[model samples]
Target: MALALNDKVLTEVYGPSTGTALRIKQVAMVVLGIAVLAIAAKIKVPVPGSPVAMNMGTFAVLTIGAAYGPRLGLTTILGYMIVGMLGFDIFQSSTADLNGINYMMGSTGGYLVGYVLATLALGFAARAGWDRSMGKMALAMLLGNVIIYLPGVAWLGVLYGFDQPILQWGLTPFLIGDALKLALAALLLPAIWKLVGDARK
Candidate 1:
């Protein structure tokens, strides 16, 4: 009975083969996922002069990573970047250009790259059979957020002398907001996973 139950679970988790139809569906889903992520980028919390502002994109990134697994998550973020580069006007404040490149290369660039890494890391964690519990999801998001900041701060130090006062604009104000965003991602991602699970069921 236990073996039979396990088989049933596996079958449910990994759907039966549908060949081309499945491929089409996957493509459609990826396109839709990109659109959703674009919308997420549009929803921003403005911060003055600081390129780092809070946005729902991270939550969408977490959701995409969990739902589509690592490769798709990475692809989706790449898609987002491409869209921005093409002047989609989806990025919160700046449109894609040389200035955009500068912004991407600036202190926030690390965080941007981190978004890709975070998605891949979190998606891989999920694929490795991490429990879809809220706690685990929160921890994953938290770690991902932190991973990006390392590069962000390092770049900031390189761009603007590290010896410069830390308070005026060196990761302090952003900390509270980032934590809040992480908390928001933690709260939302699990609910989204559950909904996706229910749809699969």
Candidate 2:
């Protein structure tokens, strides 16, 4: 009986050990996710007139959230921001231009801040197990993207002045591209989760 009890205890503990191992693997994966996001942010697909560029960082963000859930997703994005602020050429620009704190607070700053919030939103959805369904995942990503856009547009208006022409230049032109990005992220996140799940199984 004692031996049987010991075996049962070991079985219970085994799941916890596996959980710990999974968490460790998740941390490493999140770090990799951050690096990929930084690279994606820098690779601009040209869109005319608007400062809006095709950034695939959103895809990485969603993937991280879907795979690891919320806390790690937020941490990974914050880590990316810290690295970029500390003179890493991880921003949209390829060159390392760390002039001052203001550099971090410049025009696209809100978008950077939004990355965290957006990840949190998606992460929460994913934690609720929405990562398996493409439609639900798409909605989650769409909402996440909106979270980014609201603050981004608000900051643009405040910094660049609340003029109609500024809205035209800053916000309007990028809508289509942002929509496409949302669609892409929606498509990619569930697929990534499937690949990870299959690998683990």
Candidate 3:
């Protein structure tokens, strides 16, 4: 389906859109988004050679951005970061013993920064109606992953020295997982839009 460039985001389409109701809906979405991020962070599998675990946190970030649009996407990610910064175990490698700023400054620090950029990128792509097409959504998801990994790999190099196998450590190991997520989001978002379109009819 060819959604208009100005089409509403998923959140906008389902919720109250005026005054007090809109504010309440936005607040509720932010809360729910944070919860989803936290839960996804914990659902991880170890990568044999990489310090960063394979996790669904990035998938949650991408989906939230595409569904929530820029304003709310940014808000939700910032809220999640703030909670993690406050010593909450709301990150992939975070824990009670190694939580807060200290943990954030570890190897995962750059990826954390990339999360903000990726969210904004996906949110804007969704706003432009890219999320309504499987091809466009896949491209958008690919771009979002690149946005994330650029800062992430760069940070790894800086933190661990350029001589280190930064790509192997930070980028290569995650490709298969990220590609899987990209494909899934691409398929899922367009399908959801189809459902919404059918429901409206």
What is the overall TM-score of model 1 with all chains considered together? 0.74
C-alpha positional error of residue 49 in candidate 2 after TM-score superposition, expressed in Å: 2.4
Model 2 TM-score relative to the real fold = 0.78
Q: Hey, what RMSD does candidate 2 come out at?
A: 8.2
Alpha-carbon TM-score of each model against the true structure: 0.74, 0.78, 0.95
Best by lDDT: 3
Q: Write the per-residue lDDT of candidate 2 for residues 75-171, one digit (tens) a residue.
A: 8888888777777778764464442245557777767777888878777777665665789878887888788777877777778777745556556
* CA lDDT, candidate 1, residue 165: 48
Model 3 local distance difference test score: 0.91
- The regions of model 1 sitting more than 4 angstroms off are 1-17, 96-103, 165-170, 189-201
Note the clash tally of each candidate: 0, 0, 0
Q: What lDDT is obtained when candidate 1 is compared to the true structure?
A: 0.64
Which portions of model 2 miss their true places by more than 4 Å? 1-23, 98-100, 192-201
Candidate 3, residue 71: the lDDT equals 87
lDDT of 1 by residue, 76-124 (tens): 7787777766656665556645435554665556666767887787677
Give a tens-digit lDDT track for model 3, residues 20-109. Answer: 989998999999999999999999999988888989988999999999998899999999999999999899988789999999999999
Clashing pairs in 2: none
TM-score: which is higher, 1 or 2?
2
Model number with the top TM-score: 3
